[model samples]
Target: MTQHDTDHALKTGGEQGYLRIATEEAFATREQIDVYLRMVRDGTADRGMTSLWGFYAQSPSERAMQIIERLLDLGERRIADMDATGIDKAILALTSPGVQPFSDTHEAQRIARSANDLLAERCAAHPDRFIGMTAVAPQDPQWSAEEIRRGAHDLGFKGVQINSHTQGRYLDEPFFDPIFRALSDTGQPLYIHPGTPPDAMIGPLLDAGLDGAIYGFGVETGMHLLRLITIGIFDRYPDLQIMVGHMGEALPYWLYRLDYMHQAGIRSARYERMKPLKKTIADYFRSNVLVTCSGMAWEPAIRFAQQVMGEDRVMYAMDYPYQYEAHEVRALDAMELTPEVKRQFFQTNAERWFKL
Candidate 1:
């Protein structure tokens, strides 16, 4: 935006302040260590965006480390641009493809420790503004549980982060049992972000160099979420607070198609016994899932999602470092909702969701 528009944001939005769904992976270096190590083990010259270093490099990682780091340091500048886009807080977490790249549970657990420790230390510098989302290796459920508790109770983390999918294992898979139970016991919602998709599907997508934002990221992440819903993960873990972004990843709108055709196809038997997959999905979306306005701010999408999910479940986020911070702030400010709804979307709802 323009200088005047930025000033307006500071005055109007800044006065109230918003919380950022920020990440360490956002600012991390490209995949020097992680990917180099992986290449060593695999004995091949695979140049994918597998590490934080890769994120900064353009090796087809959909990486945005440079932007994320620049944006993270732009807190004051961002506020100045927003007409008082009062960014009171930023909820931080490790970047994606975090521990998922490690093949062994033991190695993944170690990576989780290192990543979580580093994140906690960084956030310690800005306790008020930065809340931590603990990283967990879904492969080692017990260790993941221990570290999550440690992050929450010991480091004062807000919640835990699980890549949308782990090692081709969905969140609804049996491996997440301990992780789920521990999170439930501690009352911390799991913050699910997208990681690389399944290996079987990655080759074709990579051949076309369209593996991330252009198409795959949202679709892969959305599939994980769908599996979680369809498999009744929330039904099993009632208190689980699962989050999915990108305007609920096209689920809420497409829900009607399934709801109307519940009596037919592969989902029919389950629907007859389970009372319809569509209703279950809606209930899970409404009751368990929380959506953030991350990188998907089409006005109609935002308005309809808020109406469908309610302002309470919606949180404002810049997807900073990966997205244009100025644009995100402007998008929220420009939403033509009643002032009350704006307040909730801009600040209140996030405060409650992140418990800020």
Candidate 2:
């Protein structure tokens, strides 16, 4: 179907007493893509990067080309796609594995700054329609912290986007405390977007052709978030808010098991890193984290997430360009949420969390 036909079929949230604010939309700059291409060519990229960006960079298929094109455009095309899908505003971030693949800290920092600048320009051009999140290279914690302050104070970005892990190093480690401090100090929520698993964990998933968004992304990112919780990140930075897409990366469904096993591990002292936390795993989720239904439009999952995560902590996202299915928007619009809850899901919650 044509874009116009899709737009016509989907009743916008405005017509249903809410505005659809898609919080996990992604965009990219050509410079960033060029760097990715170079990394793939030079054989310096990690296995996950090779599997994900290498495919995109080398694929001759029309769908791959189209996704690359869409990722590069933050102007008329992206806005039109949002309009066609009944999205009133999009909270934009650099696509996954952003600058995280660069081992050269200076190079990573430079590209991250440039990407944030370009994002700021795009958002400024259409402030009412676009909100930007800061993309930082966590390869250099101090540099990333500096960039976060600049993005929030100078560029006006709402939050910070860290694509799961940086150089196979999760943010729960002590080396990343600077970035967390910056985020807490700036009151910018951390949006942990998904990336393919690192080499240590990707071999089996890659062997099965399940290394990208199909499954590996969630498993890798969910473990990343859990690492933070178990290490008492929220207890250290009590005001640091976080967001994870794809229905909390399946975290909600496993909350009970997570709590039980986490406590068991702590009691046994099976691992040196595992320590008693200030709160249960589920409590941290309820108090510190928010979940968006990006690429997860199923009503049962959405309702279950809301029931578990609290209605206020659940929001809407389209996972644009990557999973741009107009029918997903239609499905969300057709959900049986009350007017107040629908407004919270589609609009106000994002507004409150991101300060958008």
Candidate 3:
């Protein structure tokens, strides 16, 4: 990594860790479309889930295009701003909602491939300064594996960031088994970010949307991670590396409760293969899971993660575009830890996690 902007003086250029100006959830133009427009299935269907509609608003075609163009420029400007803020690299993905917006299995795969290709090109042009994570449609098991391989081999990406669930199907669904196998085989780090309409978004809660993401993204994602842990996905695929944004989807805070529940025997048979769900979760976090300081980079949270997962597993990141660089940079710049820990969060951990 190169030295950051000299004007903002601090001890930079150290090799302890790396920084990622992340915009993981902002790439998919379609992910923002309301579910009313892309109605994939009836509510009773297997993957029966309603999509969030209020992600963005209506606009004329030409005006929408112009707005998009401006957003792209703003994204680039954010990168420059990140550079000035002392971020060494920007680990960009095709935003969130991602390919799940496409209901047709074939179409989803196609759009995902295209998005990965475009992101790959971006990384190619600025290999030193930018890195990419592949996008894949997890609607089907077979196609998901293929897309992940293509992203890694063809696009030169380090890992992937994905929504908590597709439609209504959670991560532990059988639909993702083949995909999980390939990920374990290739050792691709799968990032699981959160995006689910709140309880109010469906049925009576239709208007209760946007409410979820404000504080609900973390809760929803935490629920998903809890399910995965209880279901023992990590036990089945011990090598699978999963990355959760928003500080491990509130895992650290909820871990003790999970442990107590297990001790209280709430879900006895659920965690059959693991030593303990809490231990398994923490071990996975320490061994296979990576966490990003996307929107929740509190000093206590970051420090807690450092002690639990060690400084090597936490990476400094701005949720960028959707989350400005300042939020992330300021978090790192203001972190009250040893210089070594600060360096690790800012640079070294991400360097190893993303291979940047």
Candidate 4:
């Protein structure tokens, strides 16, 4: 691997007898909260988005505001959480719906750059405990491409974190190729984190209290990944590596059905034709995607992900603040994986994927 801008090598923990590097950890900037608050105050915020943001919002509830304050912290408190969780290092990204919701392209670009600069400063302040990911607004693909280069090449961020969609714009659209090319040039992975679904698509699910992470998040994120695969994204940028949390966002369980359905639809001559991919959905996963055990601590999910995506593609994460620290770490320990497998899941795979 090439030399990374952060001092990742110097970051290690001897206390646990094994180094634990967690990815998929999230944080938000005060500026980010301010933007959302303004949207809410002006009655311009998406109602569904407002409901989802309440989970990590800094207003409306004093307790929720405390959590938001914690999310804004990247200093001693965060490090203490890591220590308690048995994690030595964490890869940090701006929280979901980052700048992706902004309708103004210039405003989105400004927020993306500012969030990245703040995250970079924090990582530089405590390189041993944190690694940063670039936040880009896919609303302006060309400008976002430039920010990706600026963040990864100059600011020491390891990769880019894209909230699943921009407003309703998913990454599979042809307009996002510039962003993909920029990421491809860096040889850095794109972390496809979840956001609330588009307004038109959120019907009924929200009424059932199945929005946010209960189900909507997985549905939206998983479909976004499938769109990337079936829409010839991997064919265009074959070297690109995509990362997703929540144990592949429930994709591993449906791989055979997805591949089979795609083939059946093509053979029936009933579906509209688009660009053809060089490989199947399952093949792209094997060659171009990685999954992390973030937020979900179920052994069956982890084992099933390993069975389908291979142990090498799996990594460990706590999801921080949202998921309990000690419980997840204890679950990882109790999985009884071989020492070598444990090392790959805990540290080495992350090091390899992020070029740390």
Candidate 5:
């Protein structure tokens, strides 16, 4: 079927009887973009940030330009795009490398608060079509904790989005306990979105032109999640809910190996930090973590993730603007899933996880 016809069919509640609630949609405020541009100009940006945002800032390519334009729009244009792509509603968040790149704690906190306020405003303006996720500066854990509460209590945001690794520091560190405590206390899921690798890890990836979305994002984000698991983040914050996009950043496929290798490392006492956990690597995934098939519409991969992670733990995400392709929506709609399962994949799971 044609793209327009497919969209129309979905909108009209066609054979695909499910609402598409895209959970990982992204938007960026103009102020954030301006800060990114200034960082690029001043040569003070993180290497990965420079590689990703700098390219988009300067590159005149149609894809880069289109993404930039779409990222800046949170109004009718964004809603129209969603309608045209068969998405019923979107859980919106700040684009990656958000506020996490700023070394100045106050500056980062200010910008993050501004971004959260803008997102809350956009969501309120389009309550039926948009849902807001809190963005906070992890540079100051206490401030981040307070922002999380403010976003949940005052702004009505449903969850928190942290771009992976703040200034080379991962959430696995004890310093981030306040943020985790807040998330658990507030019952808001924490979506760990991908950012470009830090300086320590971006050199090789950038040299190979894979420092952005293609390879580095998954590597960095997957490592972040694994670090949380191995370091027993979930044991400390048992009530915390963590969401990872791109089919759990390919972590599901490596579950067996991860579990085995992790056990081996602990048995050998090869690393002082590798301690025993109450559960296995995969157990944490099944329990505390949720996965989204954002930018990953392939049938086999999605099905494999569902099979391994449990059907209820997997949900749909368009990865909007970055991997925006209406055909992907059509493809997901065509997956060979039973009616109930399809509904869970495209709609109910998101509603449940994000508390929509």
Candidate 6:
């Protein structure tokens, strides 16, 4: 067998099987680090921002410079981690709250551009093992559209990755139409990852130590996605595709309930002036939205996602560097799926969505 075939065979339990492609992998540029540090030094960073960085870093008491070092080392350390974990390719994106933390549009755009350039360079150097997703700050919708075009058309990024909201603004707002239209025009999928909640919005959750992935990530992202659905984003841009990680942020489990509530709310004229969507919320979930098994390694969640979203819409991800558990591959392998389903989950589905 060819080397490629042999590797696939080793990964997929045969001699010429599936190649694993993790779509929700993350990285950070040194420039991004510098900007974040500047924010911290200037006292402009969000309440939990510095502490969040420290949580991921090696040092518990201060900014995890070591973790920042690892994020910047997209070359050796990251690739080594992937290799050890049986991941043949990783679709890399900027880490959470990437350029979104920047309140200045100009600064956000500059930082996003620099980060995208860095990601593109890394992917070019390791095309077989890496693919890049473009990063854009939504502070300027027009600029974000242009950057999405540039990143996908010129830099060859696989798609776009946006943290759930820009500052406190979510994607459901009409102000983001240009951004959605741009994504539609490029035919690149957009991955909506989570960011820490605005302090004012989730103060209690933050104090309860659920600010990050444990509970808050899903709560925030799940709400962001529901907002997209209720506010008619999918209705307006039918061609635009979006992805949410962490097993659809608990959406699949509540699919029927969401549909029921959506109907009930609209029928009640809850927001009398707001227009209702043409289709059920679950229709959009199956049609325009895709979900990944990022950071969530539980078997039941993955299986439930498949049940609701269908195997074709479900793909594998490790949520690398953050939830980079080595046993995840084994967990996926142990799933009660046929080889064909496994191939779709690990390879073909991502290839189809990200144009891999």
Residue-level lDDT of model 2, residues 182-301, one tens digit each, is 998899999999999989899999999999999999999999999999899999998889999999999999999999999999999999999998999999888999999999998899
Question: How does model 3 score by TM-score?
Answer: 0.80
lDDT of 6 at 241: 85
List where candidate 1 sits over 4 angstroms from the true fold. Answer: 1-13, 16-55, 58-65, 68-86, 261-267, 270-279
Q: Write model 6 residue lDDT over 1-356, tens digit each, in one string.
A: 23333233224223336888899988987677777777777888776565565355435543355456667778988877777777899999999888898878788888889889888888899988999998998888899999999998899998999998777888877888898988989999989999888766768877888888888878988999888888888778888788999899999999999999788888888786346787888889889999999988787888888888788999999887777777667767666678899889989999999987
- What pairs collide in candidate 6? none
Stretches of candidate 5 off by over 4 Å are 1-15
Rate residue 158 of model 5 by lDDT. Answer: 95
Per-prediction TM-score: 0.82, 0.96, 0.80, 0.93, 0.96, 0.92
Relative to the true structure, candidate 6 reaches a TM of: 0.92
Off by over 4 Å in 6: 1-16, 57-66, 272-274
Task: Please give, for residues 88-195, the per-residue lDDT of candidate 5 as tens digits.
Answer: 899999999889898688888888899998998888898989999999999899999999999999999999999999989999999999999999889999999999
Off by over 4 Å in 4: 1-17, 58-63, 273-275
What is the lDDT of every predicted structure here? 0.65, 0.90, 0.64, 0.83, 0.90, 0.82
Backbone Cα, N, C clashes tallied per candidate: 28, 0, 13, 0, 0, 0
Residue-level lDDT tens digits of model 4 in 41-122: 6777775677777445645676676668678898989887776666888999998889988878788888889889888999
- Between candidates 5 and 6, the one scoring higher on lDDT is 5
Candidate 6, run of 10 with poorest lDDT = 5-14
Judged by TM-score relative to the true structure, which candidate is superior, 1 or 6? 6
Cα miss at 113, model 1 (Å)?
Answer: 1.1
Q: Clashing residue pairs in candidate 4, if any?
A: none
